[model samples]
Target chain A: MAVHHKILGVATLLYLLVFFIHVLYFSLKKERVLAVAWMIIYATICVHTLGIVLRWIESYRMGVGHVPLANFYESLIFFAWSVTFILVVMRKKISYPVITMCASLASLFLMGYASISPSVEKNIQPLIPALQSNWLHVHVVTCFIAYAAFVISFICGSLYFVEWKGVIPPKAVLEDINYRSVIVGFYMLSAGILTGAVWAHYAWGSYWSWDPKETWSLITWIIYALFLHARMVRGWREKRIALISIIGFISVVFTYFGVNFILSGLHSYAT
Target chain B: MTLCTLRRLLSFVKEKKTIRLPDEDRLSRMDFHSYVPGKGLGETVGILTKHYRLAVNGEQGAVLERGKLSRYGVFIIHTSIIVILAGSFTGLLFGYRGFVTLKVGETKDRLTLRGKTAAEIPLGFALTCKDFRVNFYPTGEPKDYVSTVEIIENGKVVLGKEIRVNDPLSYKGIRFYQSNYGSAPVFFFNVGGEKIILTEREVFRKNDLLMMVARFEGKVHDFGPGVLVAYLDNGEPKAAWFLKSVDRLREQKLQGVKVSLVDIQEQPYTGLEVSRDPGVFIVWAGFALMLLGLYVNFFLQHRRIYLLRVSEGLLVAGMASRNREDFKKEFEKLTEEINGRTS
Candidate 1:
């Protein structure tokens, strides 16, 4: 087994454990114990980061020598890392145990899928000619960060619709979070799309080919565009905004996965 | 598609309503806070107006610079999107993409479109394929595909280029991309001590010996570029095969004729994808606009603090477009200064 996989597997288990512990502590009226849970989640994120770095080093040792972000397994691990990093950084401001649990669950799910799925190859391999560009870093990092922001916004919106149900923060705070996180997501998605377009033009002859992935990305953007525009509507309020956030996140998931697995396009190799 | 995007923009416009603070009653609702040293309502408004870069109209006021910057951000962002959409529209109106296949030394005046209902579009000038070559990696993978081409206008050379993937040749606003490559077989035969070389699909006949190459393969039992050729032996058709490699040429003699490949004369055909997009610049400019607008819109928050004369000390209230917590700190500072001043 790879070193990163072993570490990340342990990290995934601990993430779930921390998530459960946070929920249990919150339920039992022991709010301070959730601090311990928070620390453990932070430490888990550190371990995850180290595991990714070690995998990068391992790839270098194997002469592949590229960032651990080129394939399904690698990108999923990155997805997990991004979620954990963002959630941990947001721990202070948002400070909701439910949010942390959801984030940890998301990371754990991704790591678990990456490890267990037969379709995902965990081995480090040389990048093909098409991926050998500086834009790989720009495109993937911006994209994953945007994805993580959407995940955060989705969690906030989901919790809001349920009225937080003994969650730490007030409903207004969650609504604020839902709005701010989506703005961050919108900006990052724009940056990601622009960078991806630049990269596409660099590798392929065309910038926007309406490939399934690109088309899905555009659809996701339009959904979010509607979400942003809905904020400007005179009578539309928080609940409607939260609903749009939920819908926009669903579009995000479909754009990221459905376009890869179900639809045939130029980005099939990315899957 | 254009109509769809245009409708989105139209709805965006319909969604926004102009906000303004124009009177004392509106000022009351704004939760005006902070007290400045002044004579009365008129003097207090003067001090407040002096401190803030405001556009005051009939007691309703807005901060000038921040409001302008925020509005500029909104303008730039929306305009950039519209410009991008318009650029795509112009591209669809004027741009056409098609591919041209050329054999070595073959001059083609038009490119073939690839689709269900494809058509040949003329370039108005001839393009000649001078050379085609490929560089290989150590693992025998193709590192680069290069095609040397020359443009011929009115039987005169205008431009010569060696194009590669991502590095296309542009002439008269049309781009020629090196998209693909291949080779055809060329056969050299020595029949009765007479030497002659013939390209694929070209018939060679001398005194009842009519010969033509059927096809060329890179490997026929690892023979390396085996040329399949057919000959009319006294008008009775017969077929023979020979390798392009010189070492393997003597190994297979086709019925008293020493046939060898002149390296199979690998007439590599360069697949040049030609396109002309006139609105590409508008699209690029739109991207530039988006970068600037996004930075302003996301990073810069418009913070406002309205001051209204009240029965007690001036009631302080504040609002920011984003980061209300950070704005709270600044709002406190403003109120502290106003509270300390002599009113």
Candidate 2:
């Protein structure tokens, strides 16, 4: 069962087009077209789910006997899917079409990179000795899930910043939602780091070796720590904190992908 | 005069015994105690001085008073330091790590110790590799490597299991992990004048001293390096010695000892990482505490909802923290529900 990467690729591209349409409709103030765009986004989400499941099956056939998270490309696809999943669920309670648009754009970028980039090979690889444990499933899935949640919060935070600076119309309702998302994201990120650390201790015999991945992750944690402190203690309002949250997410990106490609460390397989 | 001569003879005998030749007496006599004289004395003085000082100065003046230090301030600093120190120290002291490499159908007794200057097996029992295998992905990227290992104690195989990277073989409080792969050179020996080429098929026990007894023609020769002693019962082979060099084999004859070097074969095998960490549970506990602290700190916002009765059966409500806008909306909805019921 070969992974239908081409099918997934096409479906992702179609979703990207739909996301752009949503943006165009919102900018044009066309309510009917915006509703249509939302429906298309939902359909695209189902397709994305199918693509992920298909890739997982293909991995089994390829005899990796592991999840499709052995490398950066698979992780990027997972991240994009997770973000879209959260955004769709969030859209039910919050009426923030613009934030959704940003998330979709991020997801599209991940898919586009996976599909187009030569360095990112979209094939099922066998699990290395370090990744042959059951913890791989639990740890990698949880970490990426948390990462996806952060990405969503990052999008919302970016939107809040734009509205606060009057780049876009003020949406105070979305600002509170954005803060809530960040709080949730921060909690998940903490969980992700803790899980990864525990797993590392078991696999490598050392809990923290100050590897590039671990260091950057701690840096990411500290950034969110500063955001939390500013919000809870300093009584700083939403706009500045939201901007900081976005900055934190960028660090998360560097920690996850940049550290793997640009820097050499124990987590070379992650690249 | 006879008694004086006898005393002189005894003194002369004592001096002769003391001034023995190096080859005749192989041992050296020196004052070993001079190496570390002041160390023991310093420790003794340190303990005695502290004890006497404590006795002289009393607890009242020597110990810090509770009133002098703020409780909250002390708690914050001390607790954080204790947590960090406990985590680091526990991780360092009780952590044992090493690596082992073995080819298919081969067994290894010692694992390469990591982060240590000397070779030491941290585990109580010995581990022997039984088999090693590697599988590749369809994309041609090398995938999994596994090593089958047996836990041995007193020549008895207690447990047999295959250990991979994430999936380790745990026995007797130790784990073996399949980590690396490489090829090494193996040498052959021709003992007892019988031609035997030691190839990749031969397994040499690490640090094992084998006695190679050989007979060549009529002369007998005995040669050895360290514990590996070789005795030729009959050898008149004109005693030629050869040293295996990097580029070319150097031949020399030293004291009529003949040694011939043969082939060097590369043996490919897999490497396994072994570890036994008693501090892992403590590190895991720390992780649990950290996660719990984060969850409580972030997710469970300190929300305080207050309701006050004022002005003829009217209720005023307020929240102290978190999602105030949502709280306000909920409070309004609750008021509306109450009003509807009352009316």
Candidate 3:
């Protein structure tokens, strides 16, 4: 019932609207409908950003006084925001409404899960001693950006093989976007892992402890690394490269959610 | 030899070698030996290579052009992985991690190593825990665990700091992190005419009655501060609370023995994780090199164009390490520029 939650709820509804409008744009082939969807997305993002900032202010009011990147619910919100933000930024380069709809659906799912999940704690809580550091902001921001890039790439890569019958862009365009997003994701993931290591060293006196979360992150990194090597060095294309991109996103998902939910480790705090 | 065979064989000869035939023709007949471009090349190619920061090499019969950025990027990235592994390996070999628990006002110069076999190592300097304080939120979740510690060397107080989670104390290349904390409760007991003292986790035995001070509780059912005492009866452990604020339980009789609580005090002990990793900086260096290498590899392209003398004027073939489609367009534009300049 807080202001920020209401704002986010409104944003979520707008996102659903955006998805429907995208569908309309595709079915009717109306550029006006597509333009309307873009306009709604921009407003949705603004409201979404306001909600995030307001939640940060709410945490301060609650005396926690930390960034909103502390818990599972907050992370989901940030993930949704990052996905939409990245999609909009890359809108000019990738003007495919179908991709936008895929992204919108992804963000809706994240926001919906954050709001509807019974396990997620929505209240602002004080950080544990270990997470009370500046590195949390750096590490979480970079990792989510990387995840957003991968999400976009997953959309493009999946559409490449679908039999859309002229509804989708050329395979070359999708492939290029996939490749570019993977490159961005790879670099951000590397930075995220590095920052995590540095923060761990400061807090626990060990940089690399084969914790499940850390191991899964390394696995994700390796998968992406393989993707890059196969595409860039081995000159793989089309289905093979698309398959690797999808697989890499799967690893990313496992690292982000599976490790937090199923495995017990130092990152159990995330759960 | 064919281009693929030559490329595979040349992989062993040069670290940064690229050979591809975008469109193969009689131009492939030109005998080509891949040179590690930066190492050996013609002065003309070398000058252009340095000026453009591109990779250009002179083979036996043709001149090959490629962006040196990708080559060096691959080289740097691969080498950085080796460097990181080596750094961590060095840490594993040379570094030591140990733990020490210091009660307030206690000093220790040795720590027990963390591994299968417990071994103690000298810390070179003694560290004393001045105080251990833990702050908690109203929700009872701990917000901070801080230990005020001081380092002493040969009767001199050298360094002092308050170490907390994510904020550690470093002295002589060894870091001390505030890893954990526990309460060290002290209890004084008077049984009949004998007086005894016990602290947290300490066992006291007299006449087959085994007692241990388990922990100190702030409020036990609103009876005020008390100590939880565990007693072994018939080899089964049973715990009972002894309240300092209550007169009846303060001097309770157990097993025909008069056991009276005299006074109790609770102090906190700080648990510090100690480590000295000399290779951490090397690992950081590897991280820096890797970021640099990745930037080049992702954002830059490696283009290799081969020129051969032909019956009409000249023959040109081109390829790229990655982004082949984009390179096709670039190659076309470049060849047009070449023809325009010559015409």
Candidate 4:
């Protein structure tokens, strides 16, 4: 209980590190060990999922009985879980280990940063008055899923530019995947924003207070909307659309983490 | 094709919005994909009227169209957004939020509007705080603070209910939420046959013998709440630890004193937030509609088909929604089905 987060954090990293090894082993050479890698990916996902559930159980045992998604430390673990989940689900359809590597790398960084950060509170704190709602689960889960989706699209878009056909997927496939992931991310993040607004209205008597978190979420939403619109335009080429995808994911990252660290609002508990 | 199938298809077409299609026996050509310059008038009209609506169109000429959702889906999403915006604006224009603080046994009819400057507004009906209580968890964190309130209209008790943090009481047009609570220690004493309640540090003079509750102990010796009373005679004060609810005057009080325990009360003041928003229901409706619309827009894929009446045969062209390639395979299958049936 004293270091439940520490254990989960290390578990996430170990999962990421092991998955990354498979990604490296398969991507460079023409060896189709995807079955082995596929099984390994699910195994890592199970371990990562176990870690998250353990954290949740620990919070409940701590008498908080709330989801372990109230702060930055917990959200980072969730972010890693989401990314790995997406990776495993996507692996069956897209024949690319590079995407897994990219996703795992991002998860690795998030989990590592969360585990090493001295500022983030790792303890299972009781839910504050404003945070005691079912909406906490809905908003945080949906938001992290959106973030996870965007992270996948960001990897696809980045690889579309850096290495078009050698190890990563081709330009057309990556572009298609990027657009599709953005579509999913857009819907999820929109749901998250609406649920957060409703929760805010219930707790604080106002729905949209233009708080830093709200503003940044709106910004991220607008950017993705623009990306979708640009995708429809005949003039916007593949590279331009890919660039927008990356930009949108960057904005998503900022909205997820930067707002908590840099701005103060009713959502300050997320810090 | 069989006569029964032809009749069913024809009947279906007749029930739909009628439009003249290029004749199946058109002059020299029947194509599904190639477009002629419309040496005839029907071809021009068919091409010109393609954009009238958002639904599939199939004709006797074997032209099957789809992707109606492709265009209308975006419109639904956009219109739902407008609806949500309208609902929000309605809330902003008509909604009012305010709060009132009520102590036990106090009645209030006015609320202070929540803003930078406090403005008192009448609630048109009186609200009485019958009682307020706080429950704490084993960890010392507050579990709940509940207020039992009564709504009085024309001196008649119309409604009475307990309101907690997440649960609110609604009457007529407004809602009252138990937002907060606070307690203040007070000492109850009988002095010279006249009972008086003195708050902490408050002094009351009875028969020129000044008496005051100088301090309070929330708990003393685990026997429950006790207070220190200061009695002054010519500026020379006598202090005693008095449990206002217990008969402790003889045990810890000054000898020959007439003062005795009446009761010690921790008067609880409940903070109630009053809100009335006519647009909340509309806003929720809009949210539901938007969610439904987004689901339709994303989950439903549309496909369209074009048929060209050419000299060689019927040439067919296909289109998929969102420019996704996976739909092209579906379109190919549809085209193959039409070819197998018509040819």
DockQ of each: 0.23, 0.31, 0.76, 0.22
Candidate ranking under DockQ, highest first, comes to: 3, 2, 1, 4
Top-DockQ structure, candidate number: 3
Cα RMSD of all models vs. native, in order, equals 6.3, 23.8, 7.2, 10.0
TM for every model, in the order presented, reads 0.76, 0.71, 0.77, 0.74
Q: Give the Å shift of residue B289 in candidate 3.
A: 1.7
Across A158-268, the per-residue lDDT of candidate 4 in tens digits comes to: 887785446767787888778778877888888898888887667666667799989999999999888877766455757888888888888887787788778888678
- Docking quality band of candidate 1, CAPRI definitions: incorrect
True contacts kept of 2: 0.56
Give the poorly placed runs of model 2, Cα more than 4 Å off: A1-3, A62-65, A92-94, A156-175, B1-85, B101-112, B116-122, B136-143, B192-263, B301-311, B314-320, B333-343
Question: What lDDT score belongs to each candidate, Candidate 1 first?
Answer: 0.75, 0.60, 0.82, 0.72
Runs with alpha carbons beyond 4 Å of true place in candidate 1: B1-25, B36-67, B101-110, B115-172, B176-178, B181-270, B306-329, B337-343
Ranked by TM-score, top first:
3, 1, 4, 2
Native contacts recovered, each model: 0.15, 0.56, 0.90, 0.04
| Candidate achieving higher lDDT, 2 or 3 | 3
Off by over 4 Å in 4: A1-10, A26-28, A58-63, A92-95, A163-165, A233-235, B1-59, B63-67, B183-266, B306-317, B335-343
Model 4, position A60, has a per-residue lDDT of 84
* lDDT, residue B201, candidate 3: 82
lDDT of 1 by residue, A202-250 (tens): 5565678998888888888888878877775444556888888899899
Q: How accurate is candidate 4 locally (lDDT)?
A: 0.72
Output the worst ten-in-a-row residue range by lDDT, candidate 4 chain B: B30-39
Q: Return the DockQ of model 2.
A: 0.31
* Cα displacement (Å) at residue B239, model 4: 29
